[model samples]
Target chain A: MVYELYYWPGIQGRGEFVRLALEEGGAKYIDIALKPENRGGGVPAMNKFLEGPRVPHPPFAPPFLKVGKQLIGQTSNILLYLGGPLKLAPRDEAGKLWVHQLQLTVADLVVEAHDTHHPIAAGLYYKDQKAAAKRRAEDFREHRIPKFFNYFEKVLTRNRTAGPWLVGRRVTYADLSLAQVVAGIRYAFPKASTKALRKHPRLMKLHDAVFERPRIKRYAESGRRLAFNNDDLFRNYPELDG
Target chain B: MVYELYYWPGIQGRGEFVRLALEEGGAKYIDIALKPENRGGGVPAMNKFLEGPRVPHPPFAPPFLKVGKQLIGQTSNILLYLGGPLKLAPRDEAGKLWVHQLQLTVADLVVEAHDTHHPIAAGLYYKDQKAAAKRRAEDFREHRIPKFFNYFEKVLTRNRTAGPWLVGRRVTYADLSLAQVVAGIRYAFPKASTKALRKHPRLMKLHDAVFERPRIKRYAESGRRLAFNNDDLFRNYPELDG
Candidate 1:
């Protein structure tokens, strides 16, 4: 059965994490919003999910997946569900839990990154709160980026598996998500990420390894991989970047 | 074996959710941070969890639980782990996933609440970012709270069980977290939550039911349940509280 993913169409926002997993796993799925003739494209679909009748198990926000009758939401939770079936998570319970904890941490970093651009209100335009955005961006760049990178670096260096993947000997969704994060940081704050990467060799190596994976390489090379832009979470504002 | 919970000493903050679970389940555990004579008791332990490196899997933030050799972090993840063994989660995979999604959504709301005060930087003083805080709080109160509450209201109303709990018949961690969210909203935005709760009868009923539980009732009556304060996530700032 083909998985139906519902997210904003244009930019690779939070949904990109799920997109990356599907792409790397070579799983058959439809980016519902991006498909032409789908009146229930991004905005409409997101509204349907939000404003529609109360689901017995409601998802708070977008990037939810529907496979048959099962609708799964929350980026990390969705990824956790797919991890096992799509071969994106570890088999062992302990390993799976650890990977999940790492994903939750990544989700925290993503929220922080998004907030840097919209410090005042997500509903309000970025232009309206540029000054506040600058301040928040600085804190994110100086404190959060380094802190998160250092943690990921520690995990990569400390992994006893002696492999490039975050868990066990195989590639997991954590690696894919990490790659996307690294890519976003590079696009949004090139200078900061480059400097931070110098001290996180293992992390950089993992990023490079993920980039070179046969499936990941094909996904990136293909036109399917969305480029980072101002509309998405990791937006580039020179004033915000140090 | 008793569970060992490490979190900040004074504030109920994020740790209260875990405390509620332990209390409701009648589980034996040590709140290392709250104990006296252990260098301010739990605070030191919480700090050690934050700063210590000996542990293989270190938590990015506090409210982490240590069960034997396993160290679980993230409020929802901790609850997910405990929910199963402690009979807090549902039996089936679909039910478990649904509970997790609910917990994660609650986590998102929690982050939004924290951002209201620390709109600029988590490391900076709230006073320093009063202007931004005002703007953020406006958005949170005017937009976010209603949206989140409505979604949850729908969830409770749509439950097949038509019961007070979030999932099936049992009281899962999602229910506990939802109760906390309701209490936090009431504490932080009394006028708004009171108005909002009227529109969400199911949610209000669930909140009342959770509070009425014997274990939860005793826990709340006890001094262990910390009161809302400026230092915690949901602070009552009249200027920000609409």
Candidate 2:
């Protein structure tokens, strides 16, 4: 069955996390919001599912995956649902929960990353909160990024059962997500990210290995892959990079 | 099995979310962090798991549950695991995912509520970033709270099968979490929360019902329930409320 992904078009945002999993999992899915409006797509199409009275389980936000009649929302929740079906997560109950726990941690880091640019308010433009953003970014660069990276690096180092993957010997959705986050941070904060990467060789190795995989490499080179821009979660503001 | 919960002492922070579930679920559990450190409890016991090399799966932060040898981290993840055994979640797969989706949304709202006072940095004192906190609190009061409350209210109103609960007719972990968040927000932003609650009667009903439940009410008045203070996630800052 083909899965339908509903998210805002143009920017990667949270939806990109689902997209990475879908690509690596090799699931048959359509990016619903990217299609033209006449063919039942775009933000209007996405909003219909959200606002329509017929939907019993309406999502709080996008990055939701629609499998048949089921609509799964929240990036981590969507990944959890798709993990087993796509063979991207462990078959055991305990392993799946561990991978999901790691994903949630990544989600937290992502929120902090986004907040660096919009420290005062998500509704307000970055320019309006530029001063506050600068302060937030400084703390994020100096503290948060290293703290998160160090945790992941330790997790990787402590994985005796698995050679390099987060959970087991095989790659999981968490690995793909960490790779994406690392790439995004590098783009957003080149100097700081580079410094942090030097301290986290294991994490860097996992990030590099994830992209080198055939399925992921093809997706990365594919025209469908969106470029990192100011509109996305990870923006290139040199001043914020410290 | 007697489950052990580890978290920071003296605050009803994220740990309270887990405590509410454990209490309502009628599970036998120990509040390890609140226990005497001499008996393998308190912050030292909790830190041992975090910093120990023997732990295969280390949680990034607390509100972690130790069941036998397995440790589950992330508040939502812990609830997701306990939801089934304690009968706080739906048995069916679709229903479980839906409830979890709702829980994740509640988690997002909790983060924003905490950020009202720590918009600049979590590590920095609120007094240092009072100016930025004021700006962030304004947007949270005017935009974020209403958006989240409206979404939950709509979810409650649209839950045809479940009636008033977030999911099915039976109380789920999401409902308990929502109730906690609503109470926290009321403490943090009295004026804004009151205004938002006025518009969402359905949500307030759910919140009230959750606290009014026999087990929850017993726990509420058992003297174990911690008071909301400045040290907690939801602080009562009069200046930030407006």
Candidate 3:
């Protein structure tokens, strides 16, 4: 069965994590929001599961995946479901949890990165909370980014496997997600990310390695992979960037 | 085997979520941070996992559970790991994912609630960011709280099973987490949470029901359950309350 991904159109946002994994896994899936209206696409089609009274498991927000009749919500949760099936996660229970743990950490980092631009409120525009955004972004760039990057670098350093992957030797969804987060943060804060990442060679190598994968590289160059924009989570606000 | 929990000693914080589930499950576990220094408890003990160079799966932060040799990090991940063995989650895969999705949503709400006070930076003092906190709290009280509470209430309303729980007729970890979130939010923003919760009776009832469980009630009344304070994620700042 083809996986149906429901997310806001025009921006990669959180859905990009799932898209990247799906692309690498060679899974048949449809970006529901990007499809034409008649074929069951657009915001309204996605909203039906959210707004529909009968929906068994209504997602609170976008970036949900519909597999068969099940609607999996939350970015990390969606990745957890797809990880095993898509062969991007470990087969053992402990290994799977470890990969999922890493993904959840990436999720945490993403939330913090998003908040750097929209500190006060997601509903409020960045312009409305630019002052708070500046302060938040400063802390994010100086303290948070280094701390997170250091943690990931350490994880890669501690991996006993011969390969550069976070868990065992082969690539996991966590690696893909970590690369996405790195790319997004770098896009949002080129100067700050560059300096912070300077101390994280393993993380940088992993980021480049993930993107260099054949499927991921093709998908990245493919017109379907949306470019980073102000409207997305990782907005490149010059003033917010150090 | 007794589960070893590693978190800061003073605050209920995220560890409380895991504690509640352990209590409800009647599982053997130790609050490692609360124990005396001689018995391998306290902040240093918790820090070893985080700071140690050889830790295989280093947790990004505390509230990690050590079951045997494996260290499970992330509150939701810890709950997800425990949910099955503790019999607090569903037996089926889809049911488990649905419950986990709900827990992740609660996790998102908790972050937003915490940010209402520290909109600028978690490392910064609340007093330093009081102006931004006020603005963030206002939006949280007026918009975020109601939206989250309403979404949860909708989940309870749509649970096809004839029960008060979010999944089937049994109480899942998501129900426990949702209750904890409501209680924490109510403590943080009494005025706002009370007002927002008024529009969602099912959520209010669910919160009350989860706390009223015999094990949960006993554990909560026990001094073991730390009192809500400013140092915790949910702080009762009257000025920040609507």
Q: DockQ of candidates 1 onward, in order?
A: 0.72, 0.88, 0.92
Ranking by DockQ: 3, 2, 1
Candidate 1 per-residue lDDT over residues B1-242, each given as its tens digit: 89999887778888989988998889999998778854557466677666666657888888889888888988888888888778999888888888999999998898888888899999999899999999898898889989898888778777878578878889998899889988988888888888888988989999999999999999888877888887888888878786
lDDT of 2 at B110: 95
Model 2 chain A: lowest-lDDT 10 consecutive positions = A159-168
lDDT of 3 at A120: 89
True contacts kept of each: 0.74, 0.85, 0.94
Q: Which residue pairs clash in candidate 2?
A: none
In the range A154-224, model 3's lDDT, one tens digit per residue, is 99999988877899989999999999999999999999989888899999999999999999999888888
Q: Candidate 2, residues B1-242: lDDT per residue as tens digits?
A: 99999999999999999999999999999999899988887899999989998789999999899999999999999999999899999999999999999999999999999998999899999999999999999999989998999899889888877456988689999999999999999998888889899999999999899999999999999999999999999999999987
| Segments in model 2 whose C-alpha atoms lie over 4 Å from true places | none
**What's the distance in Å from true for residue B75, model 3?**
0.5
The DockQ-derived docking category for candidate 3 is high
TM-score for chain B of each model, two decimals: 0.95, 0.98, 0.98
In model 1, pairs of residues that clash are B32-B42, B33-B41, B33-B42, B33-B43, B34-B42
Each prediction's interface RMSD? 1.5, 0.7, 0.6
